[model samples]
Target: MRIPQIRLESTKAQIGLKTINAVNNIKQPKADLSIEQPKAELTIRTTPSKLTIDQTQARADVDLKSVVKRMEEFSQKGYQDLLAGIARRAQQGIELMKIENGGNPIATQAKQNSQKPMKEFGLGFIPSHGSVKISYEPARVDIEVAPNKPKIHVNVNKPIMEYEPGKVEVSLKQKNELNIDFEMIDIKA
Candidate 1:
């Protein structure tokens, strides 16, 4: 009996090589960040105004006019009474002269009717001015005020904006597949 054996072995092998090239369609996302500005406002207004005042003052014035008028009347009456007294004294002088003249009634009446006669040679003195009475009262003052007014006002305003974040997505794609295999043949003896 004879037998034969054949062993299959491989030292080196070169298989086919495959390369894949693919293009992905992608667009840049919209601008992620956003900004908002603050708001401010100012306003001013004004109006004209006016005022007035009245005042009165005096240095020498009577406080009670009615009382002053009464006093004037009294002074007039007193002046009349003093004049009557002077006339009575003159009449008494004339009567005394009549008695000194041995009761000469005609001459006494004539002297009393005539004005007083001045002596031609006698020492007599006459004043230039007569005495006068002075009268006065305290002063008075009064005051008053009136007017219109002033005011202030203020106003405000505001502005604003909203913001949002960006989004991202990820995925995979198949380009190619690689398959390699080996087989053994029949052996006999």
Candidate 2:
């Protein structure tokens, strides 16, 4: 009689690994600023000088009143006195012609002869005097000045940063291969 044989077969599982790298990102923005400036101020003022003059004394140097009076005295000649004497003599002659006390003709003639010629004497004096004067005033000046300062302003913004946390992933791509097999065969006689 021949004996019978039995057979067995088996297979093992496999494992695989996959890797990924982490990534990081960062970003920042710039800051801002502002400024302003002003101009300066100034002022100035002035006054002019003045002068004055007077001339009262210089005008009275040459006067002519006394000279004119002396000239008039020479031109009249005594005509006034001659007329008076003639009238008196005529009166005495009329008295004599009237046969009154033999007429005092001789006495009248003597009185006329005794009388003085012309009237008024001496001349009047003229006036002349004084001097000149001058005066002056000084000038004045004033000045003022003021200065200005500039203004400045600034503003800064905080840096804006964006960050992504690093990430890592682990996965199996190909499983580790492991195989096992069992087999049995029958013999012939």
Candidate 3:
């Protein structure tokens, strides 16, 4: 049997309008077996103009959920390692605040008084809590296999602090399907 050609579909959306550009049979692989599939590397570029407020908020919620899921999936030691960097940053911020408010007896006394109440109430050292939601889609793969199994990798790049920048990447696997759909959300400045 002859190998089927691979098709590529690309789409771009700006300001709620979408433009699609596609090319097929761009390249052929050398290997031919019971299964034939194409692996793709996709790069999505986004800016503030392309994103809406609702979209950004939804994305952040998804990201936060993903983080929580990851924490649950990983071992305790691994989760601690993942949070160590964030903890260090928070500690630094607290230290800076302390320094800035130093040498004022009233402020010092207030801090002490506040801390005492917090400690008594067992609410001292509150941990940062939040959720991030992201928009993303799984990759599409079309192939023929005796025992069909497909692995899909979806990489998501997310922005932090609206104007500040960041990214998120997720890899997922699926089997026996050629059509996949997903969305990536970006926070605008």
Candidate 4:
């Protein structure tokens, strides 16, 4: 029997920063400056698998400690910005789904038109003065049945930000069915 290979793909993973307001900036005579950093955290969980087979046979988990370290080196704003962007995108998806689900065309059109710009507003920007951008390559994983092994790869893209602090984490999992090949024989020759 031969085992087939399985592979899965995921969209680019991104993390966002939270807005940091400058409270008080003090400079000592020695050219040392002290500022207050905001306390904000963002947590993002991928949607659970909808398939019953997947729910029982497949599982994937991410280590928050490692993710936090990567995020710390990657983005200061943390995960808030990414969450906001995802939320906006999800809202857009829900609206579109409603339109496709036999909702009123005229009302859907009107809602879409009114919501487009508002959705864009959710992705706030930052100034470049004191803001930092952190990015990481996308992460991928492959599973093979013949070898009964799983391979993982991590890559980070360049982080882009104007002037905010944020963080991001990504995870993925998949299931596959194995097919066996056989030849049919004549029953009564």
Best by lDDT: 2
lDDT of 4 by residue, 1-189 (tens): 444444444454344444446344443333333444444444444443332222211111222335556578468555776888788678767766777677676665566557746344444333322233333444444433332233444444444435443444333333344454555444543
Candidate 2 per-residue lDDT, tens place, 1-189, comes to: 344444434344434434454444445555566666666676777787788765533333332235555466444545655676578678767765776656566766677668866897866433233344667787777777777776767676766555555555555554555454444554565
Question: TM-score: which is higher, 1 or 2?
Answer: 2
Pick the winner on lDDT between candidates 1 and 4: 1
> Is 1 or 4 the stronger prediction by TM-score?
1
Answer with 2 or 3, whichever has the higher TM-score. Answer: 2
lDDT of 3 at 96: 61
How many residue pairs of model 3 clash at the backbone?
16
Candidate 2 least-lDDT 10 residues: 56-65
TM-score of each predicted structure versus truth: 0.20, 0.36, 0.14, 0.16
lDDT of 1 by residue, 33-130 (tens): 43443333323333333333211111112223355666996899999989987997787777766685577765656776576656689553332122
- Stretches of model 4 off by over 4 angstroms after superposition: 1-78, 100-189
Ranking by TM-score: 2, 1, 4, 3
> Which RMSD does model 2 reach against the true structure?
16.6
Report, for every candidate in turn, its global Cα lDDT versus the true structure. Answer: 0.48, 0.57, 0.47, 0.47
**Model 4 root-mean-square deviation:** 62.5
Going through the candidates in the order shown, the clash numbers are 0, 11, 16, 27
